[model samples]
Target: MVRGDPIDRRLRTLVLLGLLLGLAGCAGGAHRLPYDSWRLGLFAPNYMEVWIETADAVDVQDRVFRRAMNGVAAINTPKNLKGDPRGWPTRSGAGAGKQVLGADLPRLVYVRWQSLAEPQTYEAYIVIPEATRRAMVKPETGYCPARGIWREDYRDMLTVGLAPGGIARVWLMGGCLSAIDVVRVQGTVVKKGPYGGKSGGQHRPLSATSKAYIEKYGIPYGSW
Candidate 1:
């Protein structure tokens, strides 16, 4: 009986030590930061003060285009964006573009073009750190803006990049939008695939249904 008592005490001490060690291991790994896969710092970002001026020839069509572009940029900045599992980013917003900046913690930066000028254009500068530049590759070719001639089509096709990283991506999409647009924002770390993939430039022609909505509601979407 006496010998058994000593052995039991030693066993209890060992069990307690093991539990403490396991907890310490978990604590150490919990706060570790995620590592980005792309090579950084290859693209030389020029130091240009943000400036944009539209020619006098620009028209109302150009002004409307500028307003939509601003709306898209606003949507991408904060909680309106998400990363696609297939490597592309998607907007989490309800109607138009998603806001994704704060949620994803991506290192990419987006800035709206400095002015509300005609021939409306916005610029995004992708930055790569000095380390990742070697392996970094440019985005795929399919990601271009669609030039929609119709008003409804123009609004739907307008989009901006959200939570961008070493690679910059902008996408345009159009469809039927309800009055109570519900925007859902989510985030995932993208480690591989094309920088910007899919029908980025794919423009959606204004459907008969959307035209009816516009006729009834007269620009259901609010002003920029």
Candidate 2:
């Protein structure tokens, strides 16, 4: 029990670390990370995160950012209708932004998107346990059976499961940035606004219009 004993010092360090973890685990009450905002707003336990970028470039226009979106969006669109949707750099702005699923998700896979300064937009579908998915997709929430061109809003969440596990995809309207971070789902959102306006139940139905849009433009990447 000596104050400066090796065992005593080790115990003290462990206690300090535990306290720091507790501070970080504000929501779930469990020791966890995501202490910084760079994580993808998934500050909880038992979650998995995957990340892919726009393949970085000297010229933002040269980046395969839209193709990255098209690569995944191809799952639903018609085979013949070619090309990933294009973007307008003047419209969406050149700043960074973050978005979140306001409600705890009920689906096995939840979508997260982040805009970056590396001339990239980050998006990922973090898969959860089936049981958790089932519990989260409440009747009122209408999270399963993902739908058409509508996206990044609460109402479209009903249509989020459009392609089984691949439903949660992100679309960027376009712009360019200078510097940024990886933004994994485990981070929290500090600065928030209408990264894209909330859908507020005003969603586009899975109509021919939407199908045509997807076929011609990919999954609602830029504007119509």
Candidate 3:
């Protein structure tokens, strides 16, 4: 085959074009981000029960990005408080959780809830730090697995705590049942409502075990 032959030149051009196309495909894939799944958990102290109304994602400018929950009728504290961190109640139903893509990562989470201790609906905008979001995509390693199974579910756990007088707390679950405090957003009364309704419920005394747990560890905020 001659160096400048028409047939040789044609083959070289086709090979170069194929290489360029392959490179372009790789670049596109690198920029594309994978979807991350998340579930909501809650912590309420002093036998306080909280009813979650809405938990939505907002952008930096406070624009609604995604509505995670809307009047889902879910409780923060479970009926049976066993004093075990793992036994805490997380919001159930299809809307209690969300799957977010990288491009749609929320800068803040707007949460609204009603507590039996207050006669009004309380709302707050919880910030999701850029570091936490980045960690979500690339979770830390070196943590031992549970029973020989590496649990990836911790990366998807987001817990919210409610206290009397419109106090709120937020945390992102870390590996090995660790809770990393994201921030505490003080709740503000958004609207007035009847003291007793869907948000109202019969108060029950904390179990002996749960009382002891709280006595020792204080209110289970981000820890569980």
- Per-residue lDDT for 148-185 in model 3, tens only? 64544335566666665667667676444455666776
Instruction: Score candidate 2 by TM-score against the native.
Output: 0.18
Return the TM-score for each candidate structure: 0.19, 0.18, 0.53
Tell me how candidate 1 scores on lDDT: 0.22
**Order of quality (TM-score):** 3, 1, 2
Ranked by lDDT, the better of candidates 1 and 3 is 3
Clashes of 1: 15
TM-score result, candidate 3: 0.53
Candidate 2 at 21: error in angstroms?
Answer: 19
Off by over 4 Å in 1: 1-122, 125-155, 164-167, 177-224
Number of the candidate with higher lDDT, 2 or 3: 3
RMSD of each: 24.9, 19.9, 17.1
What's the lDDT for candidate 2?
0.23
Q: Write the per-residue lDDT of candidate 2 for residues 105-189, one digit (tens) a residue.
A: 2111223333211112233333222232232222222222234332222211111111212123212211111111111223222
lDDT of 1 at 129: 25
- Candidate 1 lDDT score at position 137: 23
- How well does candidate 1 score on lDDT at residue 139? 20
Model 3 ranges with Cα > 4 A deviation: 1-35, 59-66, 70-103, 142-146, 150-154, 174-177, 192-224
